[model samples]
Target: MEDLDTLVLRTALRWQATGLPVVLVTVARTWGSSPRPPGSLMAINGRGETVGSVSGGCIEDDLIHRIREGGVQAACATDTPAVLRYGISADEAHRFGLPCGGTVELVLEPVSSRSRLDELLQACLQRRSIERRLDLRTGQVELRDGRRDGVPRLDDTHLATCLGPQARLIVIGAGDLSRFLCQMALGLGFEVVVCDPREEHRASWELDGVVVSREMPDDLILRLRPDARTAVVALTHDPKLDDLALIDALQSDAFYVGAIGSRRNSAQRRERLHMHFDLPEAALQALHGPAGLYIGSKTPAEIALSIMAEVVAVKNGIRRPSPTPVVTGKSLHENPGYEVT
Candidate 1:
């Protein structure tokens, strides 16, 4: 499935192309305890149909009611843009189903030729990050190359936001674990690729909606040269397949690089990378050996869940305790007297 943001934008563009009125809503700012952060996007059509979300169901309901009661103009009121705020008071917060003290500010703009959503969507599909600056008064927009991520900026005259590329994943092998992991990643809006040079493995690789490659893992890594928005996971138990990819992935800008193995094998993998590959200690330190957050996962599906959880945690900048990793957790389970140092 497409990422929520992309789905919203694409649906909005489709509606607009079909001569339907559409309003693009963005969460410009938020106060304590908001569900959606700044830069979140949603789109509503003339018929009150919506894609994406700005808040919980209550906020969306309010927007839909406005459209149904007064048409698209109820939200935008004009061809330009409009600013809206919700949940300033306790009663208002409760009515809108917001957490106590939560508030959200939105910019609602009527989708028009000036909105340039088509160009924006094109950039997103191409995996290019673009900053869209919307003039609050004129509804004019400017698009430029942008960083992969940033908070939305709003001023008296302009709103500057980044429309970054979708997050990507490169799986270094194809197996039951890889299939489960790729499925989870796809649902989480990651563009997933599965690479396996082994002909036997490639012959049986039949997952849908994933890019399958027969190139060697290391070669694939070098070709893709994963960016900050990319993640690499080595699932093949074979050191020949997982190690080279791990080596190259650790040297790239990928936000997460991981390998699945037993605790002892994980240590050996690290040692091999450091010695035989002449990789730096710092680079090897970035690897997630026995990849996954510890959850006593024995089945392939459960292991995939743990690994995907760790990948997302790292992506969101959520730092878990050292004891949470699979290796550490298994160690503590096997040896209760063992301490985390």
Candidate 2:
């Protein structure tokens, strides 16, 4: 599934191409709590058809009603964007389904050729992070390259919003675990790709909305050139396939690089990476072995859930305590094959 921003932009562009009057609403600011973030987007056309959302149903309903009643048209008649605030009072909060003290401010821009929705969509599709500046007085827009995601910046004259590339997940296996992981990632708005060179594994694989690649893992990773928004997870458990891809991933900008294995296997994998591959200890430390949050997951689906949870936490820059149980070197020495399940 495409991210919400991409969906909103594509819908708006399609609506505009048909010569329909469309309005694009952006959540510019929020206070207390909000269902959507500051950069969230919503678009509505003259027929009251809508795509995307700025709030939990209530605000969208209100916007539709106002558009139908010409409230939005009156504001757009001057070809200038308008700022709308919701849930200012206790009663209004209740009506709009917001938390007691929650408030949200939106910038409503009438879609036009000057809005540059097409150009923005192109940039996003090309996987370029961009900053879009909207002039409050003239409704004109400017697009430029950006490196980070930021909350909407609104000043007296303009509102600048960041539009980043969609998050990507590269699962280095097309097994049962990969199927579950890919589906979950897709639901979480990740562009998923599964790579498996084994013909038997590739032949039986079947999943929608995911790209399946038969290329070598390391070659594929090099080609993908994973950015900070990308994640790499190896579920194959085969060192020949997982290790090389993980090495490439660790050398790249991928925010998450993990491999599924038992405790003993994870330790062995690390040693192999350091000794055979001559990878530095600091680089090897980035690999999440025995990947997942140690949730005692016994099923493939449960394991996938645990792995995705950790990936998301890292993506959000949240520091979490290691869930792996501590074991002494003497204990490992005594039981060479000891594994944590």
Candidate 3:
């Protein structure tokens, strides 16, 4: 089985064939509060690299060092997974610019082989959540089921959830927020789709890999049936689109279901939902609104960034309890008329 980094490296090689340079970096492990979880990957090429990171630049520098000292070919062939440590340690952390030595282990691999990466990428495209096992004893790799973990022979968790090379995001609307949200979501590896029945908005829409549709949002929600890995963001202010999707989202188990609005708006939205939609206080309250953190974002792009950041946190399996307003800030005032008969 091929890992995400190897697949990225292979992609780099494919791009390189068309005259682009690509490098693959993987996070083999992390100490604390690391930017990316283990198995996180970033690919760089001859011109520029993916912006996120493979560890503090030391590991990147090591790869660059290898590139300079050894040829790119030599660097690429160091196929074995390598362990790196960062920390609460003092001097070691400073050297890598890690706050307190937060060690992040990296497994760097050069991409050129189409054989393994092609297979892995294929599985992801098939929407299969695969667990790829790397045999540390030997450099052999194998892909297995996430649930079964077929090859328990590995000493660690080598499973990286594959969104099939494109992370899938469903945004309801084609407005300014949707445009910004789609673009930002795409940058973060999500294959986004914007749904709106309005003809005027869909015509001018433009974003690569985003599907624009006039289908009813609720219908689309049922059809899409977002999986655990998928995220649904309700962008339109209309509860027709937003609430319907929210109902489906609440039931379907998508990782994140958020509405873009303010605190008061969120409250009213919840009240409307609880009254008519049959959604419980628990489910209606599950939504994040004023979505995004209290980032003080006034512009569309900043708002998009905040939303994307929250989505990533959700993707990383961070569990944020529904904001009770009370625990985190103030408990929301209960609504009286909304109670069911």
Best-fitting candidate, scored by lDDT: 1
lDDT of 2 by residue, 37-154 (tens): 8999999998888999999999999888877888458436666898989999999999999987999999999999999999998988788899999999999999999864777998
Cα lDDT of model 1 by residue, 214-260, tens digit:
99999999999898889999988888989989989999999999988
TM-score of 2: 0.92
Q: Give the true-structure RMSD of model 3.
A: 6.4
RMSD of each: 3.4, 3.2, 6.4
Query: After aligning candidate 2 to the native by TM-score, how far in Å is the CA of 267 from where it should be?
Result: 1.5
**How do the candidates rank by TM-score, highest first?**
1, 2, 3
- Superposition error at 265 for model 2 (Å): 1.2
Question: In candidate 3, what are the lDDT values of residues 1-341, reduced to their tens digit?
Answer: 23344456455657667875455555665766565666666766654445346665665665666555655554555544443455546776676676564777665444444225566666666666666555443445566557311222213534233223345788888878678888777666676778888788788887777888889988998998787767888877777778888888877767788887656677788888888887887776567765665454666777777778888887766768334344456423222211111
What TM-score does each of the candidates earn?
0.94, 0.92, 0.70
Q: What is the clash count for each candidate, in the order shown?
A: 0, 0, 20
lDDT of all predictions, in order shown? 0.88, 0.87, 0.64
Q: Candidate order by lDDT, highest to lowest?
A: 1, 2, 3
